[model samples]
Every structure is written in structure tokens, then in C-alpha cells.
Target chain A: MNNPGMTEVLFSLILVAIAIAISRFWKINVEKDIAIGSVRSFVQLVAVGYALNFIFDLESVWLILVTLLVMALVGAQAASSRVTKIKSPFVLILFSILFGSFVTIGIMAFLNIITFEARYIIPLGGMIIGNSMNASALSMNRITSDISSNRLTVETALSLGKSWRESSALYFRDAVTTGMISILNSMKTVGLVALPGAMTGMILAGADPLDAVLLQIIVMYMILMAVAVTSVVVVELTVRQLFTVHHQLK
Target chain B: MGSPSLVVSHVSKIVDDKKILEDISYTFYPKNIYTILGPSGSGKSSLLRLLNRLDESSSGEIIFDGQTIDSYVVCELRKKIGYLFQTPYLFEKTVKDNFLFADNTVSNSQMLELLAQVHLSQKMLESSVEKLSVGEKQRVAFARMLLTKPKILLLDEPTSALDPSITEAFEQFIQKITIKENLTTIIVTHSPEQAMRFDQTGILIADGKIAESSDIKSLLENPQSDAGKRYKARELS
Candidate 1:
């Protein structure tokens, strides 16, 4: 079977044209960003393509470790950008993504559900870290806005002899719950309503349907675990810094 | 066994190179109403916030009871000194929730009785506080303050947003709460008439300084400083 390279290029051009038309109709200041992001995405994907080709050939444990570290660092940087008020936010993001991805990957490897190999490790680690990064960013942003906007409410509670944790409990709960919504929505729509990329890719590569389904289930469970642990831990740690030792909002 | 309710020793506050309050010293005793009369931007609000350590002074000490203000935990200090804003910023909750802010465990009957003390209807409790009139909200704020049973009440133009009749009612409510609760009250108001209604001891602040500190009648009747004379003429006019 022949790959339709020209058809793919024509489809990409049509999508770009549509995006530009929509932006103009909506009067959105998105032209420059869209152009820049498109170029950057192409460059990034080409670089990743070459890197993955080489990475697949190496088959070394150290190379895999290095690739995972780079991914985690990029995830941390992305998460930190969403929360500028928080000093040392990179530390929180680093720990969250690292711990979340490692734990998920470790459990799968230990269970022998997925062989400890480059193809599985790289893609699985990337998915876990990416989802955890997003969850942490969402939780932190919500928590920061909630604390600053409702300073009086928190202070009022604190004055009434409520502990810092007790005072900001509602805000913390709201942030975590907000972050969890995406995961919950995906869970609701998975398998029946939509086929995820991993499952579809495995099926396309001539893998058995049952094996592909099992892998998808494991990946979904790992994503949920990663998001939950990262969001809760990061939010709890960062919230403590918002209050002073005197129980005043900082 | 306790010292005066509040004592400020040579307190000075500077923000962004401008002096808001400079070298202010005074003592407030328990069960007395002390009114700080000043024009807009005269640091009247800043002075009130200082007492509760909401706004820190650049120098000098604020001693509440026997301990220095800095010695007490800010949250604990704020609990003891209830600070009410010019505009009643009621939460997005029922009137009952507003009072329950200080202590949620209080019985509904106790809250209703307290509301009655402030001349508020019991029906107001179940309604949304956002829907209340300015006067009604001010009264609810007073009721809310009473829940904490604060040792001192610092009011920054509590009736500023009300109409004439509502202002008069608010004044009466202040009088009732001060006497009934035995609260040491420091009220900051621009209205000389309201200041005179509250207490005799009045401190007039002008150009970020205390121009006069005396009885309300003395300050109003026998103006001494140029600022005081000008203030008196304006009030009379």
C-alpha cells in the first residue's frame, strides 16, 4: 500500500486556511501565535522523529533514563509557567511529574503488564508526565486564585480559631475537584464513545484487539493515578506557604 | 488586672515616601467610645487599621491590654479587635452566615436575639445578605461583630453609605451595642454630628496628623488650631 504524502500535505494546508478564516471572523489576535506555534510544532516533531529513530536503535537503560529526565524537565517548565506567583514552582512540578510518572511506570513494569523496553517506556512515561503536569498546573492556578480572591473569607475563618488547613480546606477541595473533572469526563467517554491514540495505534500496527484493549485500560488507570497524586500533593504543599506562621494570609 | 484597652506609643506610618500617620500617641480605655474625626485621606482609616495591626506602622509600638500588639498572633489579635469597613462587604451567603462567620456554632435563636438588639428583623436572617439595604447590612455587620464578642470595635465610617434616616438609625444602633456589650469602640467618621453622638473624646486628624484631641464639644465649640477652626467652620456651614 502506498502512503498518500501529497494528500496529507493538502489536508494540513486546508486546516491552516480554516484556522486563519475562523480567527479573522472572530477578530481573535491569534494569527502570529498560530503561525509561530505551527512552525515550532513542525520543527519539534521532526527533531523528535530523528531522536526517536536513534533512541529505538540504542536500547540502553541509561539512554531511556536520560530521555525520561528531559521530558520531566520540559513538563516542569510548562507547569511552572501557569503559576508565576509561586516561588520555586519548578520544584513542585518536578517532583509531581517525576513521582507520578515513575510510580505508574514502576507498577506496570513490576506487574509485567508491559515489558521494560524503550518503545513502551518512552511513550508511557511521556503520557503519564504530560497528564500529571496538566493536572498540577490546573490545581495550582485554581488554588492561587481562590486564596488571593477570598483572602478575607480565609482570614475570617482563621480568626475564628480554624487552622490554616481548615480555613483553606474548601479552596483546596475545589482546586483538586476542578483538576479531576477532565479525567472523569474522559473516563465517561472512553472505549465506547472514542478510541484513544494508543489503542488505535496498536490496532493499526496489527496487534491483537484484546491485547490492545488491555494496554489501553492499564494506560487509562495509570493516567488517573498520576493526575490524582500529582494534583493533591502539589496543592497541599503549595497551600501551606500561602499562610504565615502567625496564620495571616501572606 | 488588665491595662488600657489600647495604647499607641509614638506610632508613625509611611507608605511609598508619603507619611500617612506621624508620631501618634494615645490610650483608649475599656467601655468608652473614642471617635477619630478627620476629612478624607487624613489617615483616619489607616489609624483604625493600625490598632488591629492590619496596617503596620513604620515605627513605634501598639500595646493592646498589657501585651504589645506585635506579641499577639495577627489572627488572634484580629479576633479581639473587630474592624468594620465603610461599605458593608457581606459574604455571598445568608444573613445568618454573615453572623456565623465569627462563630458558626451559635444557636439560631441567639443570632436572632442579637439581630433584634441591632433593630434588625428576624426574617432578614434567612434572606440573602446581598439583598439587604445598606443600613440593614450595617446592622448585620454589627450583629456579626457581636458574635466574636470582640473586646474592641473599630468602625471605619460604618454609616457612610446610608441615607439620612438610615444613618440616624445606625447611630442609635452603635449607641445600643457599645453600652450593651461594654465594647471599647473607636469609630472613624467624617461627620462631626456622628462623632459628637458617639462619645465626648474626639481626635481630629488633619494633613495626616492629629490636629486636636479633646472632648467633642470642646473641639467643636472652642476651636484652637487653624485646622480646627477651618474644620469647625466647614461643619457649621
Candidate 2:
């Protein structure tokens, strides 16, 4: 398949046009949103493509690390904004995403599954950070809502001479499970349901079918591990803030 | 009496610039049942919470056993000061689980004994708490709290969900344990009749201050403070 230039990209806007047409015809009141979203997505992707081109050309290890840090910060901000109970969840979210993503990446490098080059690290780091961000957000949100809604349950345990950790142990399991549920479901229905992004992109880029499948499998496991670690870390940090040093609910 | 097992010196709690408790001072003696009587939202529960350090006082000192409550490890302090909620909460599953949750060292024999004290049968221990009546659950919660071997017990409207018979029985059970275990038992009740039934020293809280503190009969009949007179006249509720 020949790599079509700007014309193909422009032609894709026809699909966006059709979406806007339908939204307007049905009086969904989302035609403006769809149009704006389409334009935003186009601009963001194009900008990312150019940036990646420049970074790949530079091939600086420090530059790659800086990019990952920036991505994690941006991802953390997006996750923390979704949670309203906690006053400032940004630092914990950032730490969780960084810890979860880098730890997996570190292990992958140690096992020689991937190299330290910009090509491999940046893309895989992006995937890891993105998934971990979602997991952290989901876990934090679930635990907060669970604890707040079930104050009697939590306080009962506390009044029974239990520590904060013991009082909320059940909630931790629930919230972490909630965080990991998506990945678990996706893992179960991976190829059977639909082609995931990484594998589909690899195949479209003319990689061998088996190679794409192998990479996709690695990506799936990486996400599962990252999500697990991130959710647990974020939930632990978040729950600590909900109680005082005296073990009282705040 | 008995060197004041617990003492609160000028305790006050302010949340969001609203006073929940103000300059509350009290001395709790061991082996005595003290009833805290108040109307709804009068900070009866808030007073109990401060004793157990479930909620911190804004400006005050709580001395437990000759030392400030802050001196003891929080978990150990909580263990020593057991609390029972108004709507009794039992962990899902058997009554035995609830007992074990309070104190993992609780034995089957001990569980059975506490259950018996609460007027529950041994068979009920194995039964799920969800299937038990509200009164039964309150008794189970009472038994479980006793399992911790606390030095003090804070009962927050513990019999609110019980019938007349059960409430009487539960009150008698509480009286028995306070004497038997030498526990400083503090019970919070909104009803003046319940306080009279206890026939103990009563602390009347009205608008976050101690309205009266004396023998329940004297406090109810020959009242002193304005709030106490209003309470006797059936006006504060």
C-alpha cells in the first residue's frame, strides 16, 4: 500500500462531516462538539507526529526521559481533575503514573524485552503511562466514593480498634478491582472482539502478522501489570489522606 | 470515685466555624453507667466521639488513666475505649465474624459467653448477621464490643432501634457489664425516660454545653440549669 500524503488526511474529514450532518439532523445539540473535537484531534495528532519526528531524529536519552515526564504530568493532571473529593491529588497521581510506568519499563529493559532507544521506550512509555493514568484515576475515584458513601461501615471497623488500613481493606480490594476490571475484560476479549490499536497500527505499517501479534501480546501484559501497580499505589496514597494521623476520618 | 478513669478539661469542637461542643468538662469514674441526654443535634454523639478520639476537640485536653489520650497509641487507645454506633453495624456474615473482627483472639467459648450475656443463643453465632433482627444485631454489636476488653465503653443511642422489652434487657445487660468488668460505661440517649431508667449520673447537653450533671433523678426532677428545667418541662426536643 502506498503511503498517501496530505490528501488522504484531508479526505478523512468527510467522515467528520457526515458525523456533524447526522448530529445536526437529529437535533442532538452536539454538532459543534463533534466539529471542534474533530479539528482538535487532527491538530493534536499532527503536532505529535511532527514532535515524534524531531525527537527520533535527535535520539537523545535525556530528551526521551523529559518527554515521558511531560507525558506523565499531563496524564496526571487529566486524572486528578476527575476526582473532586481530594484537595490536591496531582502529586500522588503523578508519582503513581511515573512509578508504575517506569518500573514496568525498567523491568522490560532488564529482561532485554526492549532496548533503551527512543524508538522503543517512548512509544511503550506512552502506552504504559496512559493506561496507568486511567487505572489510578479509576481506583482513586472508586475508593473515595466507596469510603464516603459507606462511612458507617468504615467507622464501625475503626471504632472496633482497627487501623485505617484494616478499616478500609475491603474498599481497597473493591477499588483496585474496579481499576483493573477494564484491562481484565480487554485481555479476555482481545483478538476475538476487535483489533487493538498497537497491533492494528503495526500491521498497517507493513510489519509481519506474527510480529504485530507478538508486540500486541507484550503490550497487553505491560498494561495489565502497570494498571495493577498504579491503582494500588494511587489508592494507598489517596486513602492515607482521607484519615488523620490519629486514625480519624477527615 | 476510683481516681477518675477519664477526664475532659475544657474540651470544645468547632467544625466549619460552628461549635459542636463548647467548654465541656467531665470526670468519668470506673464501674459506673453515665447517661448523656440531649435533644437531636445537641452534640451528644460528638461528646462521645471526643472521648474515643474518633473526633478531635478543637481546644481541650482529654486525660485517660492519668495521661493525655494523645500519649497512648491511637489503636491502643481505641481498643481501651470501645464505641457502639446508634445504627449498630455488623460485618456481613456470621456473628462469630463480627466478634473476631473486634478481637481476633476471641475464642468460641468467649463468643458463646458474650452471646449468652446479650440474650442470644449459641446457634445465632453461626447465623448470618444480615438475617438477624435489628435488636439482635445491636446485642451482637454489644457482645463484640465487650470482646475487646475495653476500659471504657461509649454507647451512642445503642437502643434506638430496639423495642421496649429489648431496650430494657439491653440496658440491664449494659449495667451488668459495667459492674462486672469495671468498665466506665457512657451511654448517650435522647429520651429523658431512658436516662431515668438508667438511674445513674446524667450529663445533659443542650446546644453543645453541659446543661446539668448530677444524679439522674435529681437532674430530671429537681433540675438546676435553665436547660435542665426546660428538659424537665418537655421543651428541649
Candidate 3:
């Protein structure tokens, strides 16, 4: 289980070469994307590897917090970009991902389930933020569209003396359910249908198979809880955008 | 004898710099049918929305039963002042479920009575709302409105979907309920004949203003204002 050195890594270029060659033969026209993607992945991962090495060496709490904040900002922007209809998705997305990622990390660190070190926090924070980002974006988009398209239903409920919360309750539920479906499906099919990234990465990095399974379980639970929080927060903030204070549809 | 059931005082609605309703004032008394006759864009629906606080007015106040509308909780205000839209929206569930949506504690016998009042069979309660025809859905919506025991009812073209025959029967059923329940009913309609047939107060709205208000017959026979005259002319021709 020796680590793959520079030669082996450069040899992986052949795989990308084969993909580009096939695309060229078929005239599929994605050769540029394939080539750029291969080069981009190599650069990004190598840069991250060096940066993480420095952060892990430092072990400064402030440095970890700063890194998490930067990740949160980028994650929020990426999440907000997916929701086109919302008025201003930045604050909602930022707070949601931050809340979901840090809250889970905070609880884990408090209980000593995961250490406060850079190696554990950074990777785990990335997982939590990544899941929450997807969940927030998806839930926000679904809730906004559902409430807008079901204007008649929402208004009818409002007219029936139902509060705005009660009026959009169904859509909120549907949106959150949609956001968490990925996590739920992954949870159900874990270890059977697929070996997830964290688990596979752990195994490839020479961790014991049992240890990888244990870490994967923790990651899955962390993702589920984070996604749930993100979905709920985004739905709350996004649904309010669709109505006036007077309970009228915006 | 007492204060009117509902009052819209100097209410105006503006959205996105466009005036939807302006400087409209009216008092709706109990146990009377007030037909709000207007052109397509005359703010009939907007006015109805403001009454129950579904949409707030940009200026002015609405007093419901001697208390301002905003003073009451919004949900309770809507229950006290029910609204039925032109194209009724029923939750995609059984008729019984739709009824329960308004007041979950509604008794089965009360539902039966309300349906009977709207000329609907009690057996339809078990059936899903999707199975009902448009006319049936309209009647069910009417029945649902009654379930709240609202003192004021705002209807925006409730019969717009029904055929001539169903509309005729609906008119009769609605007139009966207005008198029997003593509900202050504000109905918006395109047809002047329905307004006249109801034989009650008529308010002619044009360009978001009340052009004229009087007994239905007098207003129909002799409208004095320019907008009223125009509406009468169009109705006749």
C-alpha cells in the first residue's frame, strides 16, 4: 500500500489521455473541457494539499476559524447562484451554511467526538458546508417556486384565517424533504449501492477498512444533520420573501 | 341600528408605483347584498382583498364590526370575514378534507346542513374535490365559506364558471343564504342583470372610484355619474 509517487501520478495522465482520445474519435467536442478539467483538478488538489499541510502544522484556532469563514463565504456564493428567483440569497445562504456546518462541528468538538485540530476540522467542515450548501440552494429554489406556483392555494389558506406559516406549511415540508432526499437515499444505500467518497478516500489512504466504515458513518450522520438544518433555515427565510406582511402573495 | 358590519374608509392600494385602488369608501350593513359592479380592471378584487387584510391598503383604514381590521389578528379577521374567489381553489383532497381545512372541528351534521344550503348532496363530502365539476366545486367553496360562520362574505365573481342554468340556481341559493344567515355579502359581478336580480344595494366602481351607490333598481334605471352612465350604457348594449 505504498503511496503513489510522482511517476504514478503522472501516469494517471494516460487515463485523461484516453478520454480525450475517445472524445476526439467520436467528435464529441468536449476535449477542451476534459483536458482543462484534468489540469484544473491536479492544480486545485495539489494547492489544497500544500495549504492543508501548513494549516495542520500551525494548529492555531484562529487560523482554523479564518479558513472556515472563507469556505463559508465561497459556499454561500455558490449556493445563492443556484437560486435565481430569490431577491437576496446571500445572507440566507451564508447564515444557513455557517449555522449548519459550525453547529455540527461545535457539538462534535464539545463532545470530543472529533478533535479541534486542523486535520479533522477542515475536512469535516468542508463536508458539512458542502452538503448544507447544496441543501440550502435546493430547498430555497423548491420553496420559492412551490409557493409562487401555488399562489391560489396559499392565498386561499391566508383567506381562511391561516397564518403565513400555516399557509405555506405544505410547500415548506416538500422543499425540506426535497433537500434531504439525497442524504436519505445515500444513507439507505450506503456500503451497498456505493462506497461514498470519504469512505473510499479513507480506504485508499491505507486506513483500516473498519476504521474507514466508522468514519464514514460519522460523516453521513454529520451530513444529514447539517443538510436538515440548512434546508429548514433556507426554507424559513425564502418563504417569507414570497409574501407581504399583510399575508398577501408578493 | 348599530354600526355597519364592515367599513372601508378612504382605502387606497398602490403596488409598484401603480394605483390599483384609490380613495374608495363604503359601509356594508348586515343582512344585505351589495353587488360591486365594475369593468374588468376596476379594482373589484383588490377592494375585496383589502377588506379581510389579505392585502393591506396603502392609505386609509378598514373598520370591521366597530374595530379596525389591523387591530384583530390577521387569521381571525379572515375567518370572521370569509372570501370566495372567481375560480375557487380547493385543496387537492376530499370534500370533507376541504371542509376541515377551514375549521377542523366542524361537525359532520353541520357540514351536511351547509352542503344542503348550497344545494349539494351530503354524499359528495366523502368524494375527492377533483371528482367534482366546476359548478359543484363552486358550491362546495360557498359551503366552505359558510362553515366559518363569517359575519361578512366577500365573493369575487363566484358564478363566473357556472353555466347559465347552474348560475341561475346558484343565484337563488345565494339570495336565500344572504337573508337566512343575515350575512353582509359583497359580491363583484360583470353582469348587471345579476346585480339587479339580487335586488339590493349596488356600488358602481370605475377606475378604482365609486362612481355611484344606491338601491340596485334606481342605479340601473338612472345612473348619474359619468362612469356609472358609461357602465349602464355598456350593460344595455
Candidate 4:
């Protein structure tokens, strides 16, 4: 069978309709979410498709960089919104995601791991940016909540003349650990637990199993590095938000 | 009174346009155990917090050791004027970790000595703080704060966590440590009994101001101002 065209994709939406109908029958309350999500994803993916096609055809480094920068800005905005407490965290989140994506992808290109083609860079950059986004948000959330709750511990350390960094060290460590825990768990139980998304997708799309496996390995490592860098950046910025230069909790 | 160690000059703390502490001034002497007595919400804790620069005053100055507190580097100042919270928090892990956290250079003998000052056993060094009783945790926190050899100690209702017997002993230990180390000790307590037990200077804080400053017995038994007299009535009952 041929890969589903937009018409086939539209026909496939019957599955979502069926799910929505079942939710209605059971009064599961998530029918609104499912319906909105289906519509939003359709619109978003369609826009991304057009944008990527245009960027790829141009094949200009400036054009690709602009697109990646835009994506990083959006990713950062999304991640910062998820972090509940912090005064105006957009700049921090943007810098974290941008640094994580560009540095990793830039290294790969410089090392001749992947050519600087829009085809390769855009999708891979998107993956890195996406993973880093979640890690940054989750980590920031964890550390902020931890510090707010453990005010006495932090203030006690500060009262002992500990520097701000030294005072929040415990919370900082826990946040970074939490941010990277998902990737670490995946690394630990990847092939044994279940086939990962990338490998499965490649196999479904008729690629060689060994080739898919090799690509999956690279993808996992890239994600690991991106997540690690993002986690550090988020925690570094976040802990600063929680304490003043005078070593007092804010 | 011992030599003057800290001078609070016209200090007032206003938060949200309300007076937390209003035009309060006091001089603290080294080796003197000063007990700050006040009703709940009388800004007794607020006054102690201002001494260590934990919270800033809306208007006024605190002179620690003849210099304005703001002139000193904050971390260094805090080290010298250690503030032990009402409910002490120990860093998780061994009691040794708590001491080392305060001063990494503290030797085993020093740790034992410091713990002994707080009436803790030397065997408590390896004991995890999580496993310790609330009273034990407070003692350990007090010992840890002392590791840096602070010149002043701010205890915020310190004996609140301890049993009655432990509290009396701890109070005695505090009196001993204050004289032996010549530390400027400020304790904010709800108990008039504790204030009398310390027997240094008693300052009655009423409505964000010092209503009376006298010996604990006189302040409690023969209070001066109307506010002081009312506080005396409540305490006696």
C-alpha cells in the first residue's frame, strides 16, 4: 500500500471520530480535548510541512538558521510557561533551549556526523529542541517547588554564611537529576522495554531494520546530550531566580 | 552588662504599610543573655531577624561591633551573627554532615567539643539527623551554628522543640555558652519563666514598640507602662 496522502489522512481521522464517539457514550469528559487536539495537530503539522518544504528547497544556511532560531524561541516560550514560579523566565528558557540545540547540532555538523542540509538539520534540530524543552520545563518546575517548600533548610544554610550557590545546592542537584531522569531511564531500559519511536517509525516506513537501529542509536545519544545540557542550563538559571545575591531566599 | 556588641538605633520594619516593628532600639552586650518578651505578633521574631540582617528594616540602622551591619559582607556578617531558626533544620545525613556543612575545617575533637557544649553525646556524630528527636535536632543545629564560633547567637524560641526537662538543661547550657564564649545572645521567647531563667535583660515588645526594658522579674511582676502591666497580667495567669 502507498503512504497515506492528505485524503487518506483525512479518512484515517475516522479513528479519532470513533474514539470521540466512545468518549461521548461513556461521558469521559476528554472528548473536548481529543477533538481540539486533533484539529490543532492537523493545523500545526500542515503549517510545519509547508515551512519545512520552503526551507529545504532554498537550502541556504541563513534561511535554515532563521527557521531554527524561530523554533527555538517558540520552544523556549512554551517551556517557560510550564515553569509555574519565576519572574519573567522567557529569556532563561530561550537561552537554555537555543544553547542545547545549536551546540549539539553544530558539533555534529562540524564533526561531519551530519551534513548541514535543511533535510537533516531541521528534523534533528526539532527533535533536540523538543526533548530539551520538556527537560528544561520539568526540571525548573521541580527545583522551584522544592525551594519554596524547603525555605527553612535554604535559609538556615544562608544564615550560616553559605553562598547562594552553596545554599541551594541540594535543590539544584535534585532538579537536574529529575530533568535527566527520563533520558537515563530510557537509556537503561531502551531495547529491552519496548521498541523506541524512531526505530519503529523507520521500520514501519520500510527502512532496513539494521539501518533503523543505527539511526536510533545516534538519535538516543543526541537526545541524551541535548537533555543534559538543557538540564544544567535550566537549573543554573532557576536557582538564581530562587535566591538573592545576599544569599537570602526570595 | 557585658561590653556592648550590637546597637539597634531607631529600627522600624513596615510591611504592606503596616508596622511590623516600630521605632525600637536596644543595645546588646557580649556575654549577656538578653530575652526578648512579647505577645504573639508583637514583632519579637521580626526584631531578631533584623539583628542578623535576615530581613531589612523599613527605616533604621543596626550597628554590630561598632560598624553598620550593611558595611560588612553579608555572608561574613551572618557567619559572625548566627541565627538559629525556631524549628531547626539539619541537613540530611549524619550529625557530622551538619557540623562539616557549617565549617568544613571542624576536626573530630572540635565536633565532640561543640556537641558537648549543647549536651549532645559524642556518639551522635554518626547518627542521622532524620532519626534524631526534635530536641536532638535543635541541639545539633545549635552546635553546628557554633562550629563557626559566632560572636553572636540569635535563638528564636529555641526551646520550643524540647521536652520540659531538656529545655531547662538546654537553657542552662545556653547561659554557660554565652558566658564562656562571650557571645552576644538574643533569645525571643513566649515564656516569662524562660525569660526569668536567663535573667539578663528583659525587653517587653508591645504593638511593635518596646513598652518596658528591665530585669525579667521586675518586668513580669511589676510591669511599668499600661501595655507592660497588661502583659504582666496575662503572663501571671
The TM-scores of all predictions, comma-separated, are 0.82, 0.98, 0.96, 0.94
| Candidate 4 or 3, higher lDDT | 3
lDDT of 2 by residue, A1-250 (tens): 6586899988988988998889889898899899899889989989999999999999999999999999999999999999888889999999999999989999999999999988999999999998888899999999999999999999888888899999999999999999899999999999999999999998888999899999999999999999999999999999999999889999
| Tens-digit per-residue lDDT, A55-171, candidate 4 | 889999999899889988889899888877888888888898888888899888999988999998998888899889889999989999998998888889989998889888888
Ranking by TM-score: 2, 3, 4, 1
| Residues B36-148 of candidate 3: C-alpha lDDT, one tens digit per residue | 99888889889998998878899999999899998998888899999998888899789999899888999999988888878789899899999999989988988888778
Native contact fraction, candidates in order: 0.24, 0.73, 0.85, 0.78
Give the per-prediction TM-score of chain B: 0.93, 0.98, 0.95, 0.96
Q: In order, what lDDT does every prediction score?
A: 0.82, 0.91, 0.89, 0.89
Q: Write the per-residue lDDT of candidate 4 for residues B1-237, one digit (tens) a residue.
A: 645899999999999999999998888889888898888989999898888877788889999988999999998999999999999899878999989999999899989887887888889999988899999999999999987779999999999999998899899989988888888899999888889888778999988999999988888889878888888778522
What lDDT score is found at residue A226 in candidate 2?
A: 91
**Ranking of predictions according to lDDT:** 2, 3, 4, 1
lDDT of 2 by residue, B1-237 (tens): 769999999999999999999999999999999999878899999999999889999999999999999999988888899999999889989999998898888789988988888888888989988899998998899888887789999998888889997789888988888998888999998877888888999999999999989999999899999999998888988
Q: Deviation in angstroms for A107 in model 4?
A: 1.5
Query: Which stretches in model 3 have alpha-carbon errors above 4 Å?
Result: B235-237
Best by DockQ: 2
In the predicted model 3, the residue pairs found to clash are none
Q: In model 1, which runs have C-alpha deviations exceeding 4 angstroms?
A: A1-39, A53-65, A82-92, A99-118, A150-167, A237-243, B16-18, B233-237
Best by lDDT: 2
Better of 2 and 3 by TM-score: 2
Per-residue lDDT value at B196 in model 1:
76
Clash-forming residue pairs, model 2? none
